[model samples]
Target: MLGLNKTDSKFLLIVILLTLFTPFLMQPFAADSGLDQFNGGYPDLMQKVAIFGIFAVGFNILFGLTGYLSFGHAAFLGMGSYAAVWMFKLLTMNVIPAILLSMIVSGLLAVIIGYISLRRSGIYFSILTLAFAQMCYKMAYSVLTPITNGETGLQLSLSDPRILDGATESTSLPVTNIFGLAMNSSYKLEALNRVFTFNVGFYFCAVIAIIAFYIAIRLFRSPFGMMLRAVKSNQTRMNYMGLNTKPYTLAAFVISGMYAGLAGGLLAAMDPLAGADRMLWTASGEVVIMTILGGAGTLMGPVLGAGVIKYLENIFSKINESVLHSWFHWLPDGLEEVVVWVFARFTGEGWHLTLGLTFMLVVTFLPGGLVEGIKRLKKLTKRGGKPKDKLDAPDPEHTPTPSKHVV
Candidate 1:
């Protein structure tokens, strides 16, 4: 199905089902229930989930496959956003052109940066990427003020030419759309006095994210992907075997940049604004965190990590003292105060602390991230009552396989 093998097809199916039902899955709390504070079914947060998922997935393709960590990837993402907004300003509010242009511009910028940065390896490469990203941010914020609009950020204005779509008669800016379907349009469902919103923009972003995931899967299973993995395992060995690893690494880097660009375009399509902060080193680091937190080198880890971190930022950050107190009200007065005092440090303004601790735990105890932990748990459950046989298991060192351009 969809040109996917059984495992890939199954994975894709799961993603599709989960995305389609996100509104319900993310908001299980009943209407008017105090616990609704935890519900993340709103369109704004859901759109962010899909956007960041695409960014992390693309980052995984390069970092996961080639083991090349580029700290300036957010530069491409910001470049994409700039290109998308330009398209909207000059051509039309239709998102198809904006998206395509964003990807192309980002890909071009990646080629330039990757070609120069690939000359170095290890920490030097990381530093070089970081420097480039910082430069882009600085320039976008100051030196390139004419194009970036300085600190105010790039925003759609009523004065844009919009040659293809023409200017609106009203002074208000036009909303982004596909044909006549507005990106912000939503269908509201009311049942049992609860309101559920199905947003067109979120669905569009979700569809693109799924397509990106599918492409990542195909890349992971292809011969080129095998070569990239070989490069990761040992580029020196690959060089000794007469393979030019730089070109392959550069190709992967550019592809990943395009993915980031597409994500940036989607963000603009949904919000119609671009900011220099999007190009910041911290933003790039966040994608890195999402990739590693989920599980580096795994297919679905990045997406999972993106969702997890975004949820933390959106949901956990909203908790306040009153809400925390309400939860522990049933406890004795003294005990309740103690509980709230201790737990309060991990919610609201302290959400970042909670995120840091969770990340530390994942790295220290579950190095393979949540997905690998789940697999190990399943394996343990399956082996219930079975005797251990260490010697019968396949030896990692002696495993054999056919290869082309091997490391």
Candidate 2:
């Protein structure tokens, strides 16, 4: 519909619908009800879902298409965040310039890292990227204190020179905006005694994510994408065919890095802060988890994974014994205590344990991630009680009677 094939068009439409209706999707627990604690429709969490979705989508281009597992892509994200915050500090409070600078700076950094890391493949390549990322984190935390502000993070100040705009006249820190529209601006919709928040920041990130997804779809169907898949399947074969595969792989790595950077920029744009912790290896690993858990090679898998993980982090982490008890209060006293104890391990401070278990299940049962699982379920349902393959269907022409079998 929008210069896309039927599949791409449909995918885009689904994304648009989901993004628009995310408030209802994430907050099915009912407002001010006993399950209200499970609601995740707030602006901050919604912004996160969009931002991380971009990050995971970008990572999929490399890890999914090229089969290049990078442990350092988070460096680009951190770099983008730092660049964005600097833009906010030096330029106007507008987010456009900051976002632009972040992409450029992160892309440049990715090119450098990719060039060096692409020399080796397999574990060697992974280690090289990991080293680079860790070095960046260490430098930012120690030697780059002037730029990164060390442990305190980079924040907007009233004294800084903003050439595009005059000094900040307000007493407090300036809020990021696009011209007259504040990033934090939101509209509340009340329906049937429930409140739903529609935030400008979430929509801004959603628009960018949709664009990114569309681009990804185009890339997946392009000749270049075929080359990346070829590179993933048999790089040796490509090399033997006299194809310079290194350049192709390097290009994918750089592109993926730029995607990560763009995500980082969006995060800073939403929150207007940059910290060394953002570049940590754990953060990079989280994107890896998101991509793998969602279905690394598929278009919608990464986005789904990001949303799931973010929800778990934000919602499950809030559960306490009191909340657990409330839900199990209907059961017998002894049984309720046991059930709450068991459930408590998966929520609140132990949310990571639940995430780990889910990751393990996905990996063990659906190596292709949640997408493959969904596909399997669909296939099973389509088959009904019949066998899965066409081989089970009788063919009169192919089947010989016992009397004519010998002949």
Assess each prediction's global lDDT (C-alpha) against the native: 0.92, 0.91
Error of 1 at 78 (Å): 1.0
User: For residues 152-202, could you state the per-residue lDDT of candidate 2 as single tens digits?
Assistant: 998888887878878657888888898969999999998855788999999
- The TM-score between candidate 1 and the true structure equals 0.93
For each candidate in turn, give its C-alpha RMSD to the true structure in angstroms. 5.5, 2.6
The model with the greatest TM-score is 2
Off by over 4 Å in 2: 385-407
Q: Can you give the lDDT of residue 122 in candidate 1?
A: 82
Query: What are the TM-scores, per candidate, against the unseen true structure?
Result: 0.93, 0.94
